[model samples]
Target: MSEAVTHSVPSASTSPGLLASLDPLLREWLPRQRWFAGKGRPVTGFSLVSATEVLPLNSGLGLLHLLVRAHQPLVPTQSAPAYPADCYQLLLGVRETLPPRLAPALIGHPTQGPLAGLTVYEALHDPRPADVLLEALRERAHLGELRFERDMAQEIRSDLVPRLVTAEQSNSSLVYGDTFILKLLRRIVPGINPDLELPLALARAGCARVPAPAGWILADLPADSLGPGQGDPGDPYVLGVLQPFLQGASDGWDLALREMAKGEDFSGAARALGRATAEVHTALARALPEVTMGRAQMEVLAEGMTERLTAAVQTVPSLLPYAPGLRSAFDALADLAGEGQTWTAQRIHGDLHLGQCLRSPSGSWSLIDFEGEPSKPLAERRLPQPTARDVAGMLRSFDYAAHSLRAEGTQVSAVSGWADACRAAYCSGYAEAGGRDPRTDPVLLRAYETDKAIYEVVYEARHRPDWLPVPMAAVRRLALPEPS
Candidate 1:
């Protein structure tokens, strides 16, 4: 079984009535869904930018393309790295969206509000979506339940069968075994995917921080094969990949709570996770030896920031106060770039978040998923990124864990303290494992944190307007003072 999503409405040329259009599916329901970025606020309105229907499509398996314009600030971090929120399309479905459309945010119920009236649900737990999707992709799409279950925990040496947690993706579904998760792919790629590619290499080298390859399923995609004009109209993307399911696995955020909860701090785990991260990075680098990243990469980051800064300032005029200060910071970071390459770069996990990591039953940490995300194109996601890119992402994950606990309704002061401890623990671990002291150079940490936070702020504003303040909170977390 593949991780599939289902919903009451799907967008296609022959879609259902008002409740079936992409707009109605997520109209007043944006503020209620967990996956929905903005909850609590009634939607002003939403518009469909574009929607493509899945070919050879079936009824129960209604596949379509959809881009929505909702009333909220766009988030840069939670989204694709490029083209910050002018307009974007997210493959979505129904089952992922709660029936009531009114559910609590991770931490805030009344305050955080519901998924109703938000945007859309990307995936679902119901099997309907997954069943239909898999059938279609396998060219045998149908409406039926999978009667495959085993009593014991599985190592999942084969393909994954994650549940249809929701239906909202470009080519992915949420599948779960008794002890592993398998994200099934809908689209197929001719070459290999970096997500599964790097982790397997690391695992083969006996790396531990990452989840070892359980098994993988290969499919054909004559449609998306390389070169222009040589693709199939009816081809489903890569089918999917499978991995060991973690039982009650705590994420970086959850681990943060345990650390703070015991007052022992997560320093131990951070160090361990850091060492594991380092090893994984080292192994990955071996597979990608041509990392000649230099100022050229910095130029890309700077240019992207420049464009986003412009867009953000326009959408969230309140950002005006920090605009000049932000620009100055960008310049300072850019100044550090050297004409000659100073650091190695490689194709890495483009979309890394707290959700990407898990705490094992043995109290060890394991990472998952190399595919950055569905929103990003595979080519861009596989681009060589600075080691700092991964480092910054890890740092952000630490912060996200701590802060997300607060969002889960932890007392602000308490979660804040835990967050601090977790942050320290993670950094300490990274330093001990990475064998580098970035925190010592407060300026360096500040620059990196700002860049990360800028991304978070934009991403939250667009995805979770209510949570936008969370990233904004990092504004003060930076070592830099408000510019005069």
Candidate 2:
């Protein structure tokens, strides 16, 4: 069942004609994918950026590597201008008929197109195609405009078996032989991708709290395809990243829930996770340039937070009562900055939560997924931010775990106390690890935490109305004045 053999097929030319043929099928298929960002809008059409036939269709089983722009109608929002289209990296498998095993992966049989008579499905689900991808990465193959590169110092075995990770996620992943896991980003943008950039930086700094990338895949996109000022079109878009797999690791979220279920204290694990986070922060500071956010910068940051709150209150009217209280958090930060208060800023995991961590069988914690918030623009995600941003994210995650269990009908009256203890313990551990104590910077920490809660309120209100209460609870707590 392994299709690990390499083929010598000639690469296919990039053409709009090929995309014209697949347009109908793709329009029908794209919206249904979890990774497709334009979920509520209709796909107006598709424009091909690049296409390569990894394996020719004439070969009975074909694999096509495509980067297509999915055009969708704009939904106007008050805070930002709408983006008309999003680019996606697609690996399509073509066959005359699909086996029952791949039935779930089927996109559909194309009725009209170059693939008209064949059944087209997601290629990563087929091990043969997945194997081809890994082989390319191992060999550092250059097929058409796609570049498969690996660290010169690292050796990748070509025979590792590949299996698709079926988790409902924002991207696709393939685990190879329990040794390496490849994360393929579905939606793509120009410029340096932090998922690859951050890990490489951390590796150079000798930081063991994060996994180092072993290899990566990139695609050269056309200049016009990149939006205005994104970067030189010569900048390759990071499509996939391969890293060492933590074989026996347990997801931090799952581990926490288990401990809570048994009424056991999780403060110790939370504290260790905090220390690990501080270690990463310290390493990143040493490896990359850090900036000091002075009065001007802090004012701009506080202004952005205030604007976001204004927009969130408009969307979720339930936030109106707490709006004034929330406004105070941002205003206080701005007032302090007006008096010349300053803080350090550096690149951070823009969107951190318990779900982003893993605990090994031996109990060490490792952080993963540095891509930040998918909803944000690439430029914004890469900007330097205060370390408190990450600390606030982890603190909010503790509250989320407790509330999530309560939402599931767990009759635990001490849920709030459990969350509070973990939050305090985490900050204590962070200070012990030689990082500044977050508690001492109440103004900065409170501002970031309030900003995060506002984001969650808007997100939950739109996507999960029932779960809105989870963040709303935090809003209630955050809105109150800090105890002296």
Per TM-score, the best of the predicted structures is 2
RMSD of each: 9.6, 2.9
lDDT (0 to 1) per candidate: 0.53, 0.87
Local lDDT at 201 for model 1: 76
Worst 10-residue lDDT window, candidate 2 = 1-10
The segments of candidate 1 whose C-alpha lies over 4 angstroms from its true place after superposition are 1-180, 186-191, 223-237, 258-264, 338-341, 403-409, 412-417, 440-447, 477-484
lDDT tens digits by residue: candidate 1, 1-484: 4533222332333333322344544555454544443444445555443344442233323333344445555444434223222222344442223444323211111111222233334434434444444333333222121112221222333343546545434444455545445565443333467766777777766666776655454433344333344334653333355565677777765556566555555657776776666666666777666566468787677667666776777766657677776666666656666434355567566666556677777877777778775555556677776555666677777777666666666654455455556556666776776676546544334555667777778778766887876776666455255344
Worst lDDT run of 10 residues, candidate 1, spans 105-114
Per-prediction count of colliding residue pairs? 75, 0
Q: Which stretches of candidate 2 lie over 4 Å from their true place?
A: 1-16, 78-83, 227-230
For model 1, what is the error of residue 289's alpha carbon versus the real structure, in angstroms, after optimal superposition?
2.1
Task: State model 1's lDDT.
Answer: 0.53
* 294-361 per-residue lDDT for model 2 (tens digits): 99999999999999999899899999999999999999999999998899999988888999999999
Give candidate 1's error at residue 273 in angstroms.
2.1
Please state the error at residue 47 of candidate 2 in Å: 0.4
